[model samples]
Structures are given as C-alpha cells and as structure tokens.
Target: MAKTLKSAAVFLLFFILILLTNYETNNMVVEAALCKKRSATYPWASCVPLVNDNSCETHCKNKEAAVSGFCDTIELRQGFIDITTCYCQFNC
Candidate 1:
C-alpha cells in the first residue's frame, strides 16, 4: 500500500509539470505574434478618403513613408461612401 501511494504521488507531480510547461509555451507564442518585426520590405499604411492613386501615394510620403504608396479602397455603403487607403512598403 505504501509503494502504491508513492507511485501515485509521482504520477501527479509529473502531470502538473507537463501542464505548466504547455501553458508557458503557449503564452510566449501569442506575445511574439503581437509584436511582429520585419527586417525588409515591411509595410505600414495610412487610410483616408481619396480620389486618386497618385494623390494617395503623395499623402503617405508627407507622413514619412519610405516609399510612395498605391490606393486601396474599402466600400462602406455599396456605392455611396468608400474609404481609400495607402500602403507604403519599406525596410524595418
């Protein structure tokens, strides 16, 4: 009976260790994704209501963008309102 109790206690301690290790690993992976870094050709964008691609690129440049950007738009109300954005690509 004493040997059986010792074996059970060992099994419980090993199970707890496995659970704690798995939890720590998952936490690290999530934190890393949120603070992602890019060494080359990283992109940062600014959004605005725009009329033309050249205009958008020029706008991004004024905001310290490394390269002139292109226009990307999102439709809000089918054909009534749209949001135009510029994405500038550059090195990190």
Candidate 2:
C-alpha cells in the first residue's frame, strides 16, 4: 500500500508540472502576436478607400488582444492614394 501511494504522488506531481508548463506556453503566445511576431503597430483594418479614419480604431478595440488601431494611407501612383488600413497595437 505504501508503494502504491508513492507512485500516485509521483504521478500527481508530474501532472501538475505539465499543467504549469502548458499555462506558461499559453501566456507566451498571447504576449506575442498570433504568429509569434511581436509588433506594437499592425495594419488591421478593412482596406477601403472610403473608410473613415477612426473606423479602424473601433475595429481594433473589439479585438481581445488589440489595445488600439489607426488608419493610414498609401500612395500607389501619381494622384492615386489608397486609404483605409487600420494598424492594430497590442498591449504586449
């Protein structure tokens, strides 16, 4: 009976260690970006020329990880400007 109890205790300790490791891994992923790329600024808005500047900000706030978002414009060609790209910023 003592031997059996010892075995059970060892198993319990191993299981707890596994649980703690898993939790750490999960936190690491969340702290980083979804693809393991940690960036304060990210383009994360609906790409549309007519989108409002602050529209992306709202979208970023909706994300569980995103702290904020902004809109930016890019010039593709002469007199051609593309607008409506929201850059999302995470707390991490």
Candidate 3:
C-alpha cells in the first residue's frame, strides 16, 4: 500500500505543478489584454490617397508609450470626406 500511496502523491504533485504553470500563463495573458486603446489622425495637415500600414505604424510609434498601430479610414465633415488615420492598438 506504501507504493500506491507514493505513486498517488507523485501524481498529485505533478497535477499541482501543471495547474500552477497554467495559472501563471493565464495571468500573463490577462495583463497583456489590459492595455488601453487609442488612435490619431495621420498626415494631420491633409488626407492621404491610400492606406500605408507601415507609415501608420511609424506614426503610432512616435506617440508616447505606443505599442503598435494599423491604418484605417474615418469620415469627416458629415461623412463626406474619408481620411486615413493610424489606430494605436495598445498603450501599456
């Protein structure tokens, strides 16, 4: 019966270790998802002809504590004019 008890203890320890590791990973994912979102208008003086993802990312990188960005178009002046802007995904 001692052998069975030892095996059971080992299994329990292994299970606890796996649970602890999963908990830590979940906490990291939750922390990453806690970032605040923000956006800014690109080419502030005028509108661009096309959406440039690289430039939009660079523009967001210029902001303080910006993580990453993408390009999107937004309407202005009662939805008449569509302007491209850089949307920053996260600020941590």
Candidate 4:
C-alpha cells in the first residue's frame, strides 16, 4: 500500500509539471504573436522614431513635424501610437 501511494504521488507530480510547462509555452506563443501584431500596426516613428536615430530627444519634441514628414504622409495611423510606445519601452 505504501509503494502504491508513492507511485501515485510521483505520477501526479509529473502530470502537474507537464500541465504547467504546456501552459507556460502557450502563454509565450500568445505573447509573441501579440507583440508582432502590435509592432506591425504601429512602427517606431509613430511612438518613438528617434529610438534608432542619434537625436531622439529632438525628434520626440518635434513629434508633429516629424510624424507629418514621415508617417502622416504614409497614413498608417491605426496603432501608430501604441506601437511607438511599445517600441520606446522595449528600447529603453
């Protein structure tokens, strides 16, 4: 009876571990997809174009002029702000 209980406990522990691992992997995949979608929708300039540029501070200050020169002409305003914010945070 003791041996049987030990075996059952081990099995239960293994099963729970597998379940947790699977849940974690699925969550990672979902998060990656959401990140990709967000990046594609927003692009950097809309949120923080100067991220890669040498003059980030100036670009951020002149957002209206900068956006007008770049994104406004392109007309990709859907998730532009969100994308920019995410990009800036990620870079920072």
Candidate 5:
C-alpha cells in the first residue's frame, strides 16, 4: 500500500507540472498577441484632388506614429457632381 501511494504521488506531481506548464505557455502567447496589431480611423477634412494617398499615409504615420495608413474616400452625394469625404486608417 505504501508503494502504491508513492507511485500515485509521483503521477500527481507530474500531472500538475504538465498542467502548470501548459497554462503558462498559453497565457504567454495570449499576452504577446493581445496588442500585436491595432488600428484607428480619422476624418481627413482637408482632403482634396491634389492630395495623394502617399501623403495621407505619411500624415497618419506622423500624427499617430503608425506602421502604415490608407485613405478611404466615400462619396456622400451620388449625382452629376459628387461630394467626396476622406477618411484615413492608421495601423500600428
């Protein structure tokens, strides 16, 4: 009976060690990726025909210290003359 108890104790310890290792590894991976990529958008009120996409990207990089940026234009009015509004996406 004593030998059986010793074997059970060893098995229990090994199982607990495995559980703790798995839990820590999963927790660390989650923490690492929690903020891996984040993004934000802002209105570009000064957007005009002369403004280029590269300029918008550069502006976002400067303003938000972003890794990259893109300009998305949407036309509120659809007619012979369209009114376009520019929105900038910043990715970090």
Candidate 6:
C-alpha cells in the first residue's frame, strides 16, 4: 500500500508538470504570434486591435506586413526563445 501510494504521488506530480509545460508552450506560441502581428501592423500608422477585441479580424487585414515585420525583428528571429522564457517568468 505504501509503495502504491508513492507511485501514485510521483505519477501525479509528473502529470501536473506536463500540464504546466504544455500550457507554457502554448502561451509562448500565442505571444510570439501576437508580437509578430503587432510589429507588422503598428507601422504604417494603422491602429492594431487587441487579440480579444472584435476588431481583430479587420485589424489583421495586412497579415503579410506583420509577418514581414516579425521576420525583420532581430529579437524575434534570434532571441525568441529567451524572450518567451523571460515573458513567461514575469507573466506566468
């Protein structure tokens, strides 16, 4: 019984760790996308809407511009993973 309990506890801990890791990864992906999108549209004097805002559909009409901007940003291209780690540390 004690061995079974220990095994169950270990399994539970690993399961929680996996869940948290997955959540963090998903958040990083979303953040990267948003940063790319914002960088793209914020130039050219356009008003970019927040992700949850209803205007996002209209705001993202120029996705190519945003993607191009994302590609050009050295931080996004070279240090994206580190940036995501820092962001996660602060936000999550």
Q: Which model scores highest in lDDT?
A: 3
Give the per-residue lDDT digits (tens) of candidate 3, residues 1-92.
Answer: 99999999999999999999999999988877765533444563222324433465666676534677666777888768977655666655
Give the Å shift of residue 27 in candidate 5. 0.5
Clashing residue pairs for model 2: 44-86
lDDT of each: 0.59, 0.64, 0.66, 0.49, 0.62, 0.44
In model 2, what is the error at residue 37, expressed in angstroms?
9.3
Judged by whole-model lDDT over C-alpha atoms, candidate 4 comes out at 0.49
The number of clashing residue pairs in model 3 is 0
Model 1 ranges off by over 4 Å: 36-72, 84-92
Q: Is candidate 2 or candidate 5 better by TM-score?
A: 5
- Flag the better candidate by lDDT, 2 or 3: 3
lDDT string for model 1 (1-92, tens) is 99999999999999999999999999888767643431122122334334333454565566545455565677989999976555554433
How many clashes in each candidate?
0, 1, 0, 1, 0, 1
Global fold similarity of model 5 (TM-score): 0.45
- Residue 88: error of model 6 in Å? 24
Which ten contiguous residues of candidate 6 have the minimum total lDDT?
Answer: 83-92
Top TM-score hit: 4
Candidate 3 off by > 4 Å: 36-92
Candidate 2: tens digits of C-alpha lDDT, residues 1-92:
99999999999999999999999999887767564343344453453435435456666787535776666676677687654356776664
Better of 2 and 4 by TM-score: 4
Candidate 1 global TM-score: 0.44
Best-to-worst ranking by TM-score: 4, 5, 1, 6, 3, 2
Each candidate: RMSD to true structure?
7.4, 6.8, 6.7, 9.2, 5.7, 13.0
lDDT tens digits, residue span 1-92, model 6: 99999999999999999999999999999997765444322332222234224232234434332212211122446645322110111111
- The local distance difference test score of model 6 is 0.44
